[model samples]
Target: MRNLEFKEKMHEYSIWRANLVQAIEMYQQWLTRYGMDDAHRTNTLLNILSSLKNDRITLAFVAEFSRGKTELINAMFFAESGVRLLPSSPGRTTMSPTEIFYDAEGGSYIRLLNIESRLEDMSLAEFKNIPERWTQLELNCDSPTQMQNAFKELIATKKVDRELADRLGLWNEREAATQGVMNPDTVEIPCWRHALISFPHPLLKEGLSIIDTPGLNALGTEPELTLNMLPSAQAIIFLLAADTGVTKSDLEIWMNHINRARSAKKQGLAVVMNKIDAMWDDLGGSNDYDRSIKSQIKASATILKIDEESIFPVSAKQALLAKIKSDKELLAKSRISALENYLSNDILRDKRNIMASIVMRDIGSLINESVNTANTALSHASEQLEEFRKVDFHNQDMTGKLMAETRDRQSLYMANVENFQSSRRVFIVQAKMLINSLAEERINEVIYAAKHDISKSLTTIGMKQNIRKLFDDLRDLLQDSVDITNETRRLVKAIHKKFKDEYGFKEIEPILFDIKKYQLELEEVFEEGEAFRTSAKVTMTEQGIVVDKLYSTLVAKAKVILGRAHDDAISWSNGALSPLARQIKDHKKQIEGRLQMLRKINESKGTVAENIAHLEAELVPLKRQREELAIMIKSMQLEGQLAESS
Candidate 1:
């Protein structure tokens, strides 16, 4: 099959490879001739060249506490192995970074940073009996089974006897007696405080690495892990409990962190509504299981402002069991099959296809071919120029021509950065406008409508209940509004914090300040109306409840009026405040553009500087080579002339 796209990419990669090879060869030749063999310099250049050619894809799993991050991972990959990478209990499992890489020869190996090897071989069961030195060791095994066995032996539950605990420095009688409880922090665990499990799984072998992160506190405490590793991830999957829906913490994470860090390329985010099984019991008579799921999905979708399709409601426990048993029916029933399909089929394969088609096939081949052609011409010209250098070359005609060509090519490459920067600015402005329109306008309208509609429903129910009960109900309804408003404020604060911290801008603060001012305005608007008071004598009658109909009607009317005002406030805030956000975003983009430009300029300048140095170094040798060639040619011509004269 003559695939033109593939052929083109291959061609580009080939040219890049050839140019890199040629560069290496030229450097080596220069070093050899000058007797300047600097191994360190050569190695650095080689590493830079190699990194340009190799690329890899990564997928990461992340979430808040009790979100089943580890369980979801187990369901996906470790089902057959029956080994949990992270602790699944109520307590925290992952205290530090644990990487699981595929080791073909060694089977599995745990590499510890500062730990000793002697303590690594002990089984998990024996861990409680071992001294502090045991937890310091790095453990590595060939098989998952072997690793699990070792772990079990090392953390031997049976070995948690008083003597063993005392010897291992886990038991403190005085502290325990006074405290009335064991201190988890002070207790020594046999398992490496940081565990790394590497095995040959089909998925992992295929370059699918899942990082099961610790709780929110741990993630926050470890900045390097989130800042470095999380950003590098090609895809991130966040899990939330289906029963709880999107909690305050979940919303905080989304608004503060994940949403801000998202990019169009190499960044995919998915939310898994895990533990769907829990919702099956609490659902009311009118709430069908599917309907309940849909409602939860809708609620979550509203909170996250994401498509319903993006949130996959699943049972991690059932999924794990199904995968372990290889039961397709169970997998399908658990709804985890959708997640599996998304990951294996949509995410992994889709990314590979795109990479193959775009980067590897098109850009790689094109750049490679262009570079190879340029290098071949440059190399040939250099050789020819050496010969012409000795004869004075009729006023340096040959050297002048070659220098002009090099300058022309370099200039063309330099212009592309400006073009890219201009296009990026335009795209960002449009994108910001679209985002503000949806987030501020559409969302505000929906929330306002919902609030008023709920208030109206409360008013209608007041006709049946006594005045006291009606007042209590109104209070409850108002409390719900207060709760929602508080939640929104919390979300806004989270967003504000992230914006200030990451981008060094106070973008959300102005919007939130506006919101607070608007809320006060709304309260003032409502206070102007008559307020309802509860009374004990107001009992229900057959005709109708003796509730304050006028007050109830006024409250409902106030909700509708204030709801519109709230929405208008949101609109005004968006209109007035969004420009600031956009400006910040624009400035950020500009900064990025400038940084990219600086990088390119630096790279180009570095290349040029290196080339100049190489040329300067070779000048003497090239002159000598030209001189030698000139002498030989002259001698040959003279000998021929003499022979003819004789």
Candidate 2:
């Protein structure tokens, strides 16, 4: 069974996700009905839902050997099995950085990467590409005893000659001297480089992933863990033994890896002083135990340079025993709830905020803009419909006056057509000029510059920093493409101003050919490029492949991107002018028909009722469209409000 607190958190999260899904569906329907193109926004929403479907919140545990990190995991998530579900014996068990999560598609199994495979000069990521290189073993998760026995592989070690150990970066001469083994012939090393375990557990099934990492030595060997996985996790729980607080290796792990990974975002770090039960007192006063624990917490906080409140003192063994035996007093004494509360309240709340921000920024803005645009058009249509209804068709003087106005309208209509032609020619010239400025040649210039920068970086020792600088240059160049966008925008405004001020066309909205869409896409591409370059475990040969792949893909896509921009510029220029020109012609035709009707009524020669009826019939659908549009706008507005409140 899951803890009550986590179950509550899951319930709230599910509700939030369900509401977001509903809003997305409603927006999609609105777009389809209105014939609006929202391919980018719709795709973004789908990706969000897909991520939510696999919504895993990872909590990583980092500690040196036997700091009770494994025991904490067993106590918090696996105590229901009535045994330490993972190997948490007295000696070291977690040799490699182990990731445990429920993989419904992968089945119940353990996958291990052999240490000898490192001799291939391949990174872990490259090793993953060749699945035949790994050792796979099936596990019977249904049997606790079987799982216990299977997990003993974590503690399995091998004896290697001192020279082989040193070559593998496993031997420490100073440590050997301290242990009085200065002339040792052999050294111990972990058998595997990494371990992956997949099983069905309540918390794991609920999208909870746990990363159990070994001490500083193992972390030093795997750069990806420090660079990628640890930073990506929602929370990193660094465990320390209360009996032996702040060891040299613990301080090294904190200062180098864990702290560095979360330097940019400090929300993920948490320290746990585990095995507090080891400080129990029988002969001393009750206050002595409290004072001792407080001293340890203070000492740890001072050493770690972290807030005192961030340290949580807990007894995992007592917590596990208390929960299994239903001992509430012992559970309270264990102080496990303090850490669980932080996870449930603070960490999970931050995750929810992040998810909510994505919804607001992407989907919420999309819905708001669409609804506002529809409302504006509907208002214009309603006002025009009212003006049409007021046209009399019976008054003789009014008919004569309207006939004169129709003739005048014809002249105005010709002027509008001429203005449209003149404006379109000017706008098209400017748009094509802007498009030419943002042409493939310009893009290639930037691409070549980036290529040159990246080439220089490839030979640098600080590969990660160089990769970042490469992407920084790429982002700056991509942003330069927006200059063309700014020019095009100014031209569009000038064209819209001509139509509105000269012809009094207030119903038309600005033609929006958004260059930011392309800008955002490029941003995503660069972010992924950075991730692959900096964190991916690619060998030198694979690094060359990565660079070539990026160059080819980016250059090819750049052509298509600029080509689409050119096409959209031309299309928008044409489309924006055509509507107002059509409206002018239609108004002229309506006036001409009214003039003909008035002539008949004034001469008292024919019935004008049929003409009036025809005009009225045309308005019926316009009114209906306005009504439907109003309903959709209201619904979308309500959705936005609800999302904000959520």
Candidate 3:
């Protein structure tokens, strides 16, 4: 278990997740066993299971070129391979945004999207679904040399004429000017826009994925890396060379992408002062070396406006060599174990908590509902049994009275159903309005018009104005969606109150559909867009590149948010009135069964003892299910406490 903290934690995380999935499966079976499963609940549980099964703990590594970012990844996850699994040589190794994870369905391979794919109007997400366009390469996992050689393709570059390079957004005019190149016939561009590697590594198999982003140029070129990919990651490791501390480009990246809002701390963001081995001086003695390291940490903390503890000074090169050779002393000197500890305890734990919350929110509530239903059924069954024992089978008057009461309750149930149907009809019309307000087509229309305005505009100011207008329109649309949702909620409340007050249906509060979340997300995008619109880089970069980047990153991200909002609206529309309806239906069933039993007894066709026996039999499984549900809730509640104690 030497140098294996992160690996062990990941293994534990995977097992815990599997247990949660199993609990959901058991609940699904219980729902079916009790005849409580419906199409809506069934679909929701399936979606929850699918999400948990495919969950990944993603950590994105962001750094400028030659900061040993790739090497740090190698030392952390791939050191066990006894080689640098990802090519981490001196040059800009990760020219494209590369994602590495285990492929559950396929063999080890690298899927590279051609740089020319950027010319298409489609976003990177749209391109991912059409896999045929990516060039795929198989990796021989058994051969380290072969894998290393194959991975070099990530850094592969091709010489393209200046026109083509400019067209691809690779040729930076200011950079060219600084290098004193007046006119060059040709320039180099990365061969791929993105790389996806599916390797059968242990941690990856346990659902750990890594995103290694290239230098500033790559970040500037690809808006998806900032908008969709990095934001989605649970953690981000921003790398800096210990010798150079935060360089000018590093500051630019931090301000624009990494720590723009300084809220990255909440997302397991950490700064790695890599290549600290350079500061390991033999003549300086341990005390002097410690002071120098401490001073550098302080300086970096001040410059980055981050806590001192957030930065980890590590020698990734030494760590890799130390782990491969099993040199404990070298490993200790590298301070790699501290970073490993952070990953195992801080970052991974936070991710685990987030996923746990999702499971509880979705499955936990359903389990609670089922348990309550089971309890109610058992209680009713017990009452029936007790009353059956006390009933005089020979007395016609007693049986007749019970039969009349049952019929009266049955009448109430029928009236409740009719009223619900009417209310649902009205709600259905309102739900359509809510859904249409958040429709993809609606947002897409605005995006299309805004994109047109930006494309046709000749000035940067015009483009900025158009982009700002797009956000304003989106905000207005989202506000309309929220208003519609509130109206729908109010309607649902009135319906629930009618049933509860008139028909004696149990009070069930409705869940609010969250259009506000999307509104907040759109606001974040608006802020980021505003920052980009005002930044010097926007003016310096080519107009075409800026337009494409904005669409690919910010606009694309907004579209995704709107799409999800619409989907949520649909789900809410379907499930809103279902709880009250189910309650009414179950109540009717109870009454009808009681009525049938009383009629049988009054006719002398069935005995009171026989009815009691049937009720007792029905109560057994209900009690067992209640106990099982209690166990699941307890386990979920104790997860974090147990992990922390361990």
Better of 1 and 2 by TM-score: 2
Q: Write the per-residue lDDT of candidate 3 for residues 1-646, one digit (tens) a residue.
A: 2448788888999999888888778778877887788887898899899999999999999999999999999888888889987889876688899999998897799999999988877888888789899999999988988998899999999998998888888887778999998679999889999999998888889899999999888887787787778888888899989988989999988987886533445457889999888887899988888888888889999998888998999999999999899899988888988888888988889988899778766655566566667778778878888888887877778777888888888887778788889999999999999999988888889989988998898888888788788888888888888889889888888888888887766776666676777887888888888888888878876777788888877888888888888887898788778787778767977888787777666765656677567667867876887787667656556445433322
Candidate 3 segments exceeding 4 Å error: 261-265, 604-611, 631-646
Model 1: C-alpha RMSD to truth? 23.4
Question: lDDT for each of the candidates?
Answer: 0.48, 0.71, 0.83
- The lDDT of model 3 is 0.83
Q: Could you list the CA RMSD of all candidates, in the order they appear? A: 23.4, 8.1, 2.8
Relative to the true structure, candidate 2 has a C-alpha RMSD (angstroms) of: 8.1
N/CA/C clash count, model 3: 0
Segments in model 1 whose C-alpha atoms lie over 4 Å from true places: 1-56, 82-86, 89-92, 103-107, 112-146, 149-194, 263-266, 282-287, 349-646
Give stretches of model 2 more than 4 Å off: 119-133, 160-168, 181-186, 393-646
Per-residue error at 136 for model 2, in Å? Answer: 2.9
lDDT of 2 by residue, 32-70 (tens): 675553455556557666766777789999999889899
Using all chains and alpha carbons, the TM-scores for the candidates as numbered come to 0.42, 0.69, 0.95
